[model samples]
Target chain A: MDWHQLWTIISLPDNIPIVGMIFIIPFFTWFGLRQGFANDRLLEKLEGDPKLARAHHRKTQPFQKGWARELPVWPYLLRMEFLAVVIVTFILMVWSITLDAPLEEPANPSLTMNPSKAPWYFLGLQEMLVYFDPWIAGVVMPTLIIIGLIVIPYIDENPLGNGYYTYKQRKFAIWTFIFGFIILWCSMIVIGTLIRGPGWMWFWPGMTWDHNRLIFEINRDLHEIIGITSQPWIGIFGGLVVGGFVTVAGYACHRLIVATEFTRRILGRMSLLQYAILQALLIIMLALPVKILARLLFRIKYVWVTPWFNV
Target chain B: MEASKKAAAKSAPLATNGSNGSRQLLGVTVDPQEIKQKALMDLNAIKQPTKTEVYKSIFRVKHDQTARSRTLGVLSNVFLHLHPARVNRDAVRFSFTWGMGGISFYLFWVLTWTGVLLMFYYHPTKVQAFRDILYLEHDVPFGKLLRNMHRWAAHAMVLTVQLHMFRVFLTGSYKKPRQFNWSVGVILLVLTLLLSFTGYLLPDDQLGFWAVTVGTNMARATPMLGHEGPFGPQFGMTPFNDVRFALLGGSIVDANALLRAYIWHCIAIPGFAATFMIVHFWRVRKDGGISGPNRIMLESEIKPLRR
Candidate 1:
């Protein structure tokens, strides 16, 4: 086929070509002479020559001497992950069996139900929206959280903690990470679960993440006294730039405060533990907003099969 | 002379055979005639410059490179191709720890695939919603697994996307060139959560109904969304007119909500996400792999020629 006809490979779905791969692979293999591989000296040496095989295998053996190479976090994480997956599956199965929620009405296009809530998971965002304007809940906070997440590997791209304690050396970052996670999450959940009612509230009853939306509004009004651009996009972009600048500058300053080698070691140790806790807190926090929103908006409540098992 | 030539020929094919075993790019096709033409054209393009070399020769042969050379680049030489490389291997670890982003992407893949299968069974309406889910779960082969994988993967994507952010924040990856991407990631993350929200509203069960109710209620609460009376405008639209209409598709949440969420979750949000994600990963590689003070690959070591 000509180039125009050939470009169809690009337009075909991801799998269609992959399916072609299953056949095209062997087609090319035989066409290129699959029977020829046997003629290959390397292949003959690998399979037929004992001495060459032995030499090659021996040369590639791992160096046991390096304390570093023995480290194995990937496997460890994989095992732990498997356990988590199994446990979660078992729990879901049990819940599905026991809860046996009524199928309820058939999906009627015209029907409306009260205490209409979102899926329990989304209660967090739906709940957050209660406090902040749609621009904030639907836009700002969720945006910040995910954008913040995607940057993790970039920030700590250091292969330092590849084995176990990834940030074992960065005590300052550990605390900073944990602190941010906890503060952000706990505040969201607390605000979402407690203040929620007909809508969001800023006081104890049922306000959302921006419980103080009007307060922030007042502050913005005050800032306008000087000359702060209050446009949402401008505010968001400006806030990010300012926050990022301050954080980097702050990290540099803090690095100087705990400058000793021993202190540095101590800091690293603390950072790792804090980092782990922060990881947990993040999971909890992520679950919270959606969960609360789901419950509040959809009336779809969650029953942790074993209340304690719930994150 | 004949015996020596045969022996050398046998050895030559060995290396060539090994080289041929490498994985081809996804869209490459190598027909025999095409290969012959391409190889010859490539040979001419790279041939040592002859005595006729002049200003005219500069544009003549070089501009007309064979498709093969363009596909393969100048890396075909053993020395160059072996060392030819890119993307530090360590960069792969920068993903959200539990494979959330990838999982999300994969879920999208699964959803699209299964969604097609589901389309065979599902029609976008209150009538078809529950039956399709039930049929898929009970009737279709591995339908339950497919549905379960889609549902679980969606949830997992949400979790993973969040964790990914947490990782980025702690590591400070969002500082600069990545900031816009981070912003895009955030948009994608919200879209992911939105996808989950919308998808949940599809099955047309109590779970689906109540979920949309609370979702819309929350939507209405935001001054930008929910308002009331004559002046209640959503995101600046006439009250109950614009955003909610777009969200629910009509005046209230019924079949409209289910249908809207399904379309957006299945089509719109994911399409938007995939578009941005391509940009996200490209921007990432542009920014360079994750950097830190003590990366393993960064340490002074035998830099094995490229991978």
Candidate 2:
């Protein structure tokens, strides 16, 4: 293993955030879920004893007979905020002193940067360019992601877990978020930053970036693999395949939404429009991994192709 | 002699009215012993500065340990007033909210101050931008440190904002009354990204130039607006008059693009982002402060759906 090569990538000033993120994301996730699980255990205890539920404060936080439910912002919250500011300033000061921001040679349109990447945050979208057209990856996907996030509260009809963390109470919501944010968005950014090297080729973590390397893999469209050459037939077959995948995926998401009695009750609360939007978003989200798998494992390129676009 | 007699008459009644037995004539009072005692008392009160007129004028409230003073401490100050006078006892715990939102705001302030300082040395023209950065790094006093702080704080802000959103989602803080504020937050998130993207082009270095080139190239495939996008040609879009052109101000990343990015980064987008941030924080207060680490509700207690 080329430990030097791995170190070079990790030690790059711009890559530090992603490296930090690798630990920060999981640490925070575990930190949050730990509280969630603790709340769940408390929830179980309260559910079994209605008398304690009525008398008890119902929060995991310690309480006494006459303690105030709220604290003064002057000394309590303000002190915390002041401490946070000081801590953040210290971190920023040390970071700025130690590491220099990157500045390369003067910009020349004639010379191109091999494997030119966007800011670390946009790397997830840049990575999507490998699997889809720029229109879909760059424009449509970001728009959809923003819209989906905006509509989350309007779409989520479950009322049990409001204002608190509880994995058992918000199993579907929490899992979906983990899958979308932690698994999809963050992992893609990590892959784009560390794994994808010169010429935009995949290099294992410790592998040297060989600029002259070449792979002879041949990728084919789904219709082409099935030997459909005519224009009308190709379009029709591709459409059918895409439609079938959507139908199956939609059915699976529906089944999961109605999996438990609690979920079914939550699902019942959603209006038809809410349900439809949720399913559409879920299907589109699932399509990304499906397409990635198709391209990686089977060397399948486009599943659907037309004069206007390809998917 | 007549004026002196009239002044004495006026002063004699005022002397009787004065509790300290000071004599007054017209607007002037003459009482050496009383004035000396009053001055001594004032000097003594200065030891407790909070009781002084100057401090009270600015603060407009007592600084004693009373509960009223504590509440007014947060409620009366312009900056601190954004926070309510009181909050849930558990909300102050670092584990509850992770304190990411406040950190994100702090970083924004850091970026603003550093960015303003950097701007004093920067010129946005194509000829000067790169050289200015080099000058900043090599010659300007603490310019390198200033720029580094701005850059790192920006990166830090982005991470913290995302984590803040994640925490909000995990705690289900976006439910019910907070739904609209959450939407506002998503817009703020977009603005934050755009702000970072625009700033990336300011240095005019190859790293920034090409990174921007790759980023804006994607806009060229924006379905109906871009020249190369599907049906774009049919709608009369071209390299000279497309969405990408609007973004770059030309067919390629050039002088115009640099100017555009500079304007957006330093002026327009910050203005927009600041406005949205105002709305976001205001709504947070209106929506009942930070959504809690409240008691978890049982599934059996699910309220009936309001048709």
Candidate 3:
């Protein structure tokens, strides 16, 4: 099809006038103006007014504020968001299960093969990561970007529109922002393409990674990276079973201990009494396993960042 | 006044006294030849709020200000489909703002729904991802709406974020007190966009495939894409072999890229974004509660714009 055909295919709905939508969509959208007249309180409350009473009093309820109103089951979260995801996941699962093609075998490394990309979402980053050094692309950049994000509210102290900015007013912010966008993230997309090839994307032996880099059991390089010796005991049983458990347990314990110290003696009055108990139990539950596993198998050197989930 | 009402009835039967029907005001009746002079008097009543009444209205526990809250108030009076109130009624108002770690739980909620639904039929492999999308559009139940909402919400999240940025900038909210958080918001925005763009490519159609190809090629223009690019001769690397291979999850858009995109879209980036959003909101609450600059436009000013 021609470009014109593509344009026809993507045209906005008829109700949205072409020229008007450009200016209208943002303003009307931000104001939520089209939420309809009945959705406004002044209009609804006017139902008692002699002029527009019949037209008001909200035939339907207007949403309320403060801590007093009843809320949807998920609170701030929307029902549709979950619904849309669940329905789609199941549908995709069914479609894939029934399809004729085979899921390629347990991923092979020796096969100097075709198409070795990460998940497509990361492909954009992996595609970008190709340009930079490995440490920068894979480790330093992603971590810093994420950590940097944790400080947003502390940085943008503007208490105004809650969510609106003009280009000029936001120049420094907009300019510095481009680094994360066009540079770092785009590099991540490049990484998958540039970094992968046969073995760990490196010529070294312990470039150890399972298909999709699953690292079901941590290996020598991973151990050395964590400043620990590569013991067969740790590799077989300790790392595989005990290490995972104890690490998670230790973190749980730390969180619990912290919580307990902070809790007041008068718990019965606080609604959080149950929550505090639950958190304490979780700590014990995790800590016990760490103790038991360390005694049973090889010792865990330290609580290092795991290959999966980055922590 | 009753006399004027009778006289106006001779022409416009619905005219009421002291309404727009009066031919004379303050005894300055204009002549028939110069009736136009009379038509020009300020043709409206000032909707002036009494100071006493306005103050009473302000404290009237019922009429709390804020556009979103007011909208909900109206919705509550009539249609009762949504859940009942929960005391913290204003939670959903800033539902659009993703605060610190860069996004709200709501956006994650949106991502999860759209991501999972897309995953149901999506193949992480190049050949099938596009077909799956086609199946979703043409075959699945309510699939189009799901896809459309997913796409639109992603777009809305982007736009809202930009607006959120503007709100910060205009208010000078991203200053010393909010600088780091501002930077974080910027990163989150980038991540959000990256998430949206890669998902766009997952379908594996010409649009999806070529867009990635072209987009990456533009990046390769930055002294990469290897040796085959326009500047590849200068850089001394094979063009297609240089930068392009890293993109397609193999040599082309294939299983690897799809799977990678799926994993990141469903998990990693979102995981990171969520962690940050929590911190962002928490800090906002601790720092001084969410910023509430007097940002509402006056109705009278709005009326002129409307006309």
Q: Give the chain A TM-score for each candidate.
A: 0.37, 0.99, 0.31
For A40-146, candidate 2 gives per-residue lDDT tens digits of: 99999999999988887888889898899899998999999999999999999999999999999999999989879899999999999989989999999999999
Put down candidate 2 lDDT per residue, B1-307, tens digits, no spaces: 9999987776565443467676665667778797899999898887787777788899997777889999998889999999999999999999999999999998889999999999999999999999999999999999999989999999998999999999999999999889999999999999999999999999999999999999999999999999878788988999999999999999999999999999999999999989999999999999999899787788778779877
Q: Which residue runs does candidate 3 get wrong by more than 4 Å?
A: A1-21, A24-311, B1-105, B224-244, B294-307
For each candidate, report its DockQ versus the true two-chain complex. 0.09, 0.75, 0.06
Cα lDDT for residue B285, candidate 3:
51
Q: Rate the local accuracy (lDDT) of all candidates.
A: 0.48, 0.92, 0.44
State candidate 2's TM-score: 0.94
DockQ of structure 3: 0.06
Stretches > 4 Å off in candidate 1: A1-105, A108-117, A126-183, A186-311, B1-100, B229-239, B290-307
Q: Rank the candidates by lDDT, best first.
A: 2, 1, 3
Over 4 Å off, model 2: B1-46
Which of the CAPRI classes, incorrect, acceptable, medium or high, describes model 3?
Answer: incorrect
Candidate 3, residues A149-228: lDDT per residue as tens digits?
54444433222223222222233334334444333333333333333433334212223332464324332233444555
The weakest ten consecutive residues by lDDT in model 2 chain A span: A157-166
Ranking by DockQ: 2, 1, 3
